[model samples]
Target: MLKMAKKHNMCFALIKLSQTHKQQLPAWLHCGALLRTYHKLKDACLKQIHEVKSIKDLLKVSNRPTTVPHHWESHDCICGLCVSDRLAGCKNPHKCISTVAVIINNLTPKFNPFYCPINDGLTLTHCRLEKNTRARTQHRGDIIFDPSVSETLQLAECFRIFAGDTRTAQAPAHRLQRPNQGQGQQEPPIEIYTDSSCINNGKNNAQCGSGIWFGENNPLNKAIRITGKTQSNQAGEVAAILIGL
Candidate 1:
């Protein structure tokens, strides 16, 4: 009925009809704008749906809690810490006690092979890589040691050779060769001693140095010392052993 208007003002008035005139307006006029808005909203929803190809993708896009998703006891929840962070070795804060705390508390302790600091490759059964990044479902071995006993004070098996003991340092030495009694060969034992010193053990600007002593029981023996970038005790120990060997 409003299309019958002859003046421009009359057409504008018809387009801006009051609430009462809405009931009488042509149905097609109201539908065009509504369809456009509905199409825009539907396109946005479809775009979101198409972006997600799998459940994992959907979860990645979801708003999740910052806390751990599963109720796992890092040490004893029956699920070990390795379950999180893609098996890269569980770094859960809860486990700092049952694990590193033993060392801090000056007690003798064994550890889960996955978190075993130096011996992960030897203790973790499934450590197949040259790097000890992954651990097996079952551990390989448990190393027993006492922190109360100092490495220096402990009676090394090697010194027993000088005491006229018949047994050797190691039952089957990997680094030592046996002297044949029949050959009556007499060769001086080679000693390679290593030690590390840190100016400040755990500070930001700490300094660390390692000392290597190589030679027989002679006054002419010499020592070499080296400084490293990191000042950590572990880093120094590892460096000393690596360089000494």
Candidate 2:
């Protein structure tokens, strides 16, 4: 509707201006005179939508060529050249400069990978371990020790030492010293570590074992023989902790 109103006004102004000025204009100037009058009417219509800052801008807007219809094209519209002219000047010079400065400051610096900051000469390049050294040996020959004799000796010593030490039997001190308890008397908290193994995981004889380390020196240590279930050392360790919990 706005475009139609602009065209109608332009046509009316051209007719009126030509009738008034025809006597003073030459015959060859008819087209040029009408075109100038049409542009003046178009400029007046544009003034209602946008601000004109200077005489130069007003004259440029008022002297732009009129668009002629093309029959080969399905629609008639002016190109964007005149519309871009309306927005050409920067209204805020300071804001434009600040925006450009921010853009320049954000760019990342380029560096060679061989001389990159993290890889620049301060890092060690090799391991320090001796390549062919052998570990020390523990015993020259195997002499099997009697497991029951050692156990009996250990148990006898424990009994002798604890016989005079009444603290282990004292319920109040026992409960107070219990690692897990906060107050009063209670059983000590126990932590267990376990492991298991199998000859074959899918369908063969399997074995599992678990060991308990109780108290500071791992005293009262015990291990259980397990079979028929397959698992790794890590899985056994987890199972031990779970059972202890």
* Candidate 2 clashes between residue pairs 3 or more apart in a chain or in different chains: 194-236, 194-237
Q: In candidate 1, what are the lDDT values of residues 137-231, reduced to their tens digit?
A: 34444443322211122112212212321221211111223556456567767667777777777998777767667655655333434455666
lDDT of 2 by residue, 9-35 (tens): 331111011111322222221222223
Clashing pairs in 1: none
Error of 2 at 141 (Å): 70
**Over 4 Å off, model 1:** 1-189, 216-228
lDDT of the structure predicted as candidate 2:
0.33
**Local lDDT at 104 for model 2:** 23
Task: Tell me, by lDDT, which candidate is best.
Answer: 1
Candidate 1 whole-model C-alpha lDDT, 0 to 1: 0.35
Please give the lDDT score at residue 26 for candidate 1: 26
